[model samples]
Target: MYAIPDSRLPLPQVLDRFPAGVPHRRNHVNDYLLVPREVDYFNGFLALLGRAQPPLQTDQLATAARNLNDVAAGDTPSPCIQQRIQHAHLLEQLLQDRDWEPSADISRELKLVVAYLHASRQLIPDTVPGVGHLDLAIVIDTAWPKLAAEVANFVDYQRLRHLEAERQGRSDDAIAFNRSSWLELREIEARLHEHQRRVREGSYAPEPFTYFRVH
Candidate 1:
């Protein structure tokens, strides 16, 4: 949960896959960071990527996780691994949430990131022992700076939707409220609470002088 500089975020364990001295590691990381700058090229690359390789199959994922059951070897999966998986799903859900529409650039970028996850081959071959899937984390962390706000807003929208459903005496999942209505409700609630707080506190006033004189 601690913050680190973006440049240093690709886990050290993944970088260790390089030999004691090799420029391949540095070049590989740079490609990820820099390629997104050329919008047309990147988009075309993604299109070709989709056509070139089949999506990661369910069996492939199962094979990757089969090692987790080796209790005798004490191979415990990291909680962060599950968190990353959930985060990927969250990004997908955000794109689909009809109430919150994203900017065109954001929509395209999200599709690229999701497509990267679905692709069978990646910058770092998934077959590598320890750092196989770490590249996926690196890609997500790299894109997170641009995506964090939109994701946060989507989360807030979801929270307010559930609250709105409760207020309407409807099931949380059944409510069909939109973001505009939620925003209006939020503003009105905020103003009313502020007014109530001011009323309860009375007007800001100077302290009254004590009538009784001390002997």
Candidate 2:
């Protein structure tokens, strides 16, 4: 497991501290979408680590965090609640099934939940009170945690693979190849982060969810 030295450090500072070209990867399909509750859990986990990284990039991470948590806890459910509950159930089932072990990564599982939430936003009608204009902050608030988790997991997996190869006495050439692949993944992650940053800045808008929107 990768060690986080100080969770109190802000996310931007953490990103700045890491080398510019470290590799990262997208999460597996099943674990891509995260529900609001899961987002709260993740942020709390970050707080426990002593670093404060919020999924959304707005200056007010704490407020954003609380708002999402509130949404999850409130009695009147968000329009996407049913879908999220269903997705969560499916995930729980998959996680419980031992036959699915080889295909599972806890990080990926979490990411799929994030992806589902992103997709779920579309389930709300354009006529819905708060969702009509689909704000970028809302999108980022929903998407960033999964993206971050995927990148982190990619790094962790590569590190473990490299160590395993070294222990197995793999040829130096093979090890070099793995390292190169890992570096490429890092580059991909950097691009993803940049892309997400742009999306947050309204440089790009997500494609409309044809199937998700309630007509």
Candidate 3:
């Protein structure tokens, strides 16, 4: 990745000093720079830090930041600041992994995921319960097939089951699996397309073929 020069403070410290409210746009020379979304992520990080008695782990921080962005974007009803902060920390850790060098395909894919998460967050409300979490997972799953196994294991299967139940008109359960299943399916389809493209380009080999004979 093109190394943006390191910020003056460590990620946590920078987050600590983050200011409140939306950031302003600044023009430098001919370039119009929107305030770095990272600033929002950092502010959200601090907010999360304040709520949790113990500081969150790096991975948690990143996830919270992404969540906060989603809340801010109106994707969710407005996730609590604490949740946003935890997500942010998780994202930061993922981005900082030394294995994600700019030249590597994985690094590029990671950046694409971050950008997608950022854009998605901007598109929805942050407070919307579970929007950030679900959307973030969708982005990761779409962008990184290698991580699919982990995601599959971690996803809320009960929620999916509940969604299926709701679709069948069962309101008795009272569990609101309000997540957008259609969107998740669309994301999965997009990932499949991307995987196919990679295989066609010889960037990645196709997985072993599995055939099922319909009885």
Best by lDDT: 1
Cα-based lDDT for every prediction: 0.53, 0.39, 0.39
| Residues 1-215 of candidate 3: C-alpha lDDT, one tens digit per residue | 21211221112221223333524232211121223454356335433323222322333334434434543444342334334344333445456533222324355554555555556444223334444343344233234344332223223333353456677777524533323543474467679999999778775555566886778
Full candidate order by lDDT, most accurate first: 1, 3, 2
Residue 109 in candidate 1, Cα distance off native in Å: 1.5
**Whole-model lDDT, model 3:** 0.39
Query: How well does model 1 score by local distance difference test?
Result: 0.53
How close to the true structure is residue 48 of candidate 2, measured as C-alpha lDDT? 36
Better of 1 and 2 by TM-score: 1
Number of clashing pairs, model 2?
22
Q: Using TM-score as the measure, which candidate wins?
A: 1
TM-score of 3: 0.25
In the range 3-71, model 2's lDDT, one tens digit per residue, is: 322221122232213334643232211122324554455444444323343442222333322333344
Candidate 1: list runs displaced more than 4 Å. Answer: 1-80, 124-132, 196-215
Lowest lDDT 10-mer window, candidate 2? 7-16
Give lDDT: candidate 2, residue 182. Answer: 54
Candidate 1 at 133: error in angstroms? Answer: 2.9
